[model samples]
Target chain A: MSKYVMKNLSDIEIIESVKRGNTADYTMIVDRYKDRAFNLLKRMLKNDMDAEEALQDSFLKAFRYLNQFREEASFSTWFYRIVYNTALSVIASKKRKIEKEMTSLEDMPELISYDREIYATVENPKDYLMRLIDKLPIKNALVLILYYIDGLSLNEISLVMDISLVNAKVLLHRSRNILRDLLLKHNYQEEIL
Target chain B: MNIDELLNDYIDGSINANKINELKELLEKDEMTAKKLKALKAIDVLMRTIDYEKAPRDFSEKFAAYLAKNRVIKKDRKDFVTPTVLSLFMVVMLCILAVSFYYSYLSINDTEMISGILLDIFNGVSFIAGNKLFHLLGASVSFIALTILYIMNETHRRFRKKIKDL
Candidate 1:
């Protein structure tokens, strides 16, 4: 089936088809979630190759154990849990590799390059505000992305990150404060009403 | 509680109307607190406007290939029967073998000594296949049946625990 057609099916129907040995039904799931899962994994792992490999591994594990799924949780939530775990494993594996390599931060290749065009585009007050947000810590970055970019609520972020509601709120508050400080440090003088 | 907590709650929309009124009064009076709130609101807007990087287009295809390979491996590993099923199959096989052997012995043996041995085997097999109460009364099948019963019970218990964990 085409990716669009497969993506349109409900998760429960896909799962039912999977249980009946229709492996192609699972391909639909992979097609629907792969980009989002890979994006999350890439941000968490901070490497393209490792994120890709981990995303593949996670999908395989999820497919192999489809029969064990209990359906008590939403399919996306459950699948994301697997993806999160796989990304964590990839991070741990990379850490081990780095320790073996005995490389310092200075020796590592820079993954994030600052773009002059992006910097120059801050001609408007709103652009300056956005630039400041990009300077937050990775965890804060993820929280901001989920809450703002993905339009998920704090409760949904909590479920995705496996944190409590109070903690999610605290993280969001802290991230906002950090971003505000960054903007002030940059001498952003726009009347932020 | 404090200005910071109130501001945080207010920005997140978790503050009650009473708290909002109190915070509004504070913001009206304190220039620094008001400035902080403004900065925070700006940051919130900034966050809402930022775009994230997208994952590559081939991610799904690669992930599907990996999953297919893993499935093949899992299927190969699953060919072996579970312990419970294996034990049940063994018990059934042994029962059939014993019955066949008994019939064969009766057809071939005619001497009294051999006949006696054959009768003993038949008695033992019958006792093993009989009621638990009969076995408990020291019937010849007592040991064999007890052993099989223990194996079966343990297998069942373990199977139940495994299922529960899953």
Candidate 2:
């Protein structure tokens, strides 16, 4: 893996390059982070088109405000924070705009495959597991995804999500319990034993 | 710890080895705890097995376009400061002019009144313009010093706003 892919350049380096108007350096940043950022946003938004749009918006916002990036954190971590917030904002706006429309899992093509696996594993299928996870509050879902799927440490998640480390740990715990209970209720027992 | 807390740490491999050993011992003694652990392990396996998809093919291209557009807008806004700085410079010049007039009024002899006034205005304008020019040049030289301070303050404000939004 490229050093840029595995480890981010120092925030100071990025800020210096940006200040010098070496915008091409930012392209290196984009190339390095776009995949992880896209995956994160895709999971958060649970929709391909929405995730794409939000990722674009987030990258634009990050670039526009690149000067504001402080040297207190790694560039990739800080950039992911922007991506997370942008995805949340996009999802919230979408929810408000389409209040009456039925939120079918199938509507989000990227999520459909996950829903299928979840459905295949549980007796209750669509009604129990998929719906349970889907109905989880956005913050809980985010915490779960960041902690579990992304393999980010609680401290890292806290920094990215701008929450206290204690809160991040608590949310991760609660989300796991919720998922466990939902899976149990759906009779996903075969996988358990 | 409780099963809920352990479950997250266990799945993430963050739980200490001591805790894991303790949990394993408890699972041996308590069937319900064992069942819960089993379920959690299964869920973790399934989650891991699921493929983590990448973004669409054109995502980088679209993102590049978006970044370019936003960069232009940001540059325009940053450049917009030149006019404001000029206005501030004018304000400081006016203040110096006023001060010079006041001092000249007290210092000038009666016979040299007209010449003194012209001299006062000329000296005041030169002093003010010269001071400001030197300050601006100094600012440009140590650009990182004041620029970092200003950017830090603005970034702080933005961070607070972002937290509030969350």
Candidate 3:
């Protein structure tokens, strides 16, 4: 099928096609989600190879359990849940410490001073901000990517990450403020304006 | 509300008309609020424009190829169906071989073999069917035996699928 027709098919339609033996239709699902999920994994794992592997693992898993899918939940959210959990497993396997979800940030938006060395290497304020987000705590960076990059809402983010809505809001606000503080400190506020 | 909350609502498009004017007044009057607004707007702009890290260019194609290699079209049901069909095919082959071997020992040429074999099989079946009670009992036994075989084969297929999945 043409990419246009494939894109027009709903998730349920694609899934039904897959079940009906047009197995190639599954490529549409993979194409639809791979980049966004890969971006999330890249930030979480901080390694390209690991992120790609985790991305493959998550897709394989979602395909395997496609029958278990319930129609009530949006497929994007369900698939994101798989991608998020797979990234966590990769993190755990690497023995990487997941920054625990703090009940509250007493010193909210407390970020270290912008690294001068990092400032020297990057070209623009956008790249600088990306690096700053990369340096955020895992959950915080995730909340930012989901909301801004993937255009997911705070409620959708909470569902994907298995956190409460309040935690999701806090992570997003805290991460954004942290980036804002870093930008102000580095005199990138003018460029932003 | 604090200026941070107000700025956030403004950024999120949640600030009402009245709140928008209030925020504008706050931003104009306070250097700190003005600076904060600029930074927040910058960060929001940068984040919204952030590029999605491209997965390998052939990612979906590679995954589709992988699915084809694994023959993953409802593979669970296919897994069981395949083995059971192969096993029954083997059994039929064995029966055919045994019948041919018996015919060879009886010195029948190809010309006589077909009718002889058919006659012998017909007589054998008639002898068995001559006893209605025995015929019914044999049919019931065959049904139970086939059901058990199906159940056993299905269970084995599921177990293997689980192992492979893990």
Candidate 4:
């Protein structure tokens, strides 16, 4: 059957299908969230090949342990948690330290000036924001993507990131400040806004 | 209370009218707070523009093939059924053994038979020790250990030689 037909099936149903030895049905789950998971891994690993491999590894892991899944949280949240930890392990094994560098206010310009022509010429603020997000520290980048791009609530983001809710909120707050500082440093604070 | 918290609440729309009034008062009181709010709001707008990547066209097909290959291995293992049957069989055998032993114990009303069986086991062990079978076992174990050491040394020597030749 086509994945579109299976799209209407709930996660519980898909999980049941896999449990019943309809292993092929698992492709539906892979098809649904591969891109979103890929993007998260890509951002975390900062490499295309590593992200793709992690994505595949995570899917296999989720399938292998599908019997342990409970309905306490949404499948998306649980699956995302697995993907997050897998990416974290990959980063850890490589001995990469993802430190958040707080930009000092001194790096910002003294005066904020705006011009109408600058705003008019900016084709896509979203695309511009993506580039800015890429420059952010890993932790801040993750929080921004989880909160804004993935549309996860604070509680969900906390679970996925395996941090406390207060920490998640603080991370989001810090991410905005960092992004703002970046804009200031680049002198796009007035024009982009 | 802080500018960051205030802007976050404002952006999330989590602020009530009282908090909104407090924020408004802060904005009017300080130009810096107002400018910060404007910049944060703009950043929030840009954040929404981030898009999701599309899965490769062959992702599902490729993954399905992998699952198929995995299923073949899973079928070959038969991990679930074999272990379950083995466990059940062992439990039944244990139960039978326990029941039979209990019945035999009950039938043996006299203590003489129990002492006789224990004495027979002791004599059998003594016989083995007297025949020097224990010495034979020790000698065999030593031989195996020496063989293992010799093989290890030879392997190491050959490995070094191979490396030197390379």
Clashes of 1: 0
Candidate 3, chain B, TM-score (2 decimals): 0.43
The backbone clash count of each candidate, in order, is 0, 0, 0, 0
Which candidate achieves the best DockQ against the true structure? Answer: 3
Better of 2 and 4 by TM-score: 4
**Candidate number of the best lDDT:** 3
Ten-residue segment with the worst summed lDDT in candidate 3 chain A?
A102-111
Regions of model 3 farther than 4 Å from truth: A101-114, B75-166
A1-193: candidate 2 lDDT, tens digit per residue: 3865435665566568766766656666666667777777776777888877787777777877776776777776788799988986886787743222113333334444554566665564323343545555567666666665566778989999898998887777666665665566545756444
Q: What is the lDDT of residue A110 in candidate 4?
A: 28
* Superposition error at B142 for model 4 (Å): 64
Each model's TM-score for chain A is 0.71, 0.69, 0.90, 0.82
- The true-versus-predicted C-alpha distance at residue A116 of model 3, in Å, is 2.6
Number of the candidate with higher TM-score, 1 or 4: 4
Better of 2 and 3 by lDDT: 3
Query: What DockQ would you assign to candidate 2?
Result: 0.21
Instruction: Return the top candidate by TM-score.
Output: 3
Stretches of candidate 1 exceeding 4 Å from the true structure: A1-5, A96-136, A187-193, B69-165
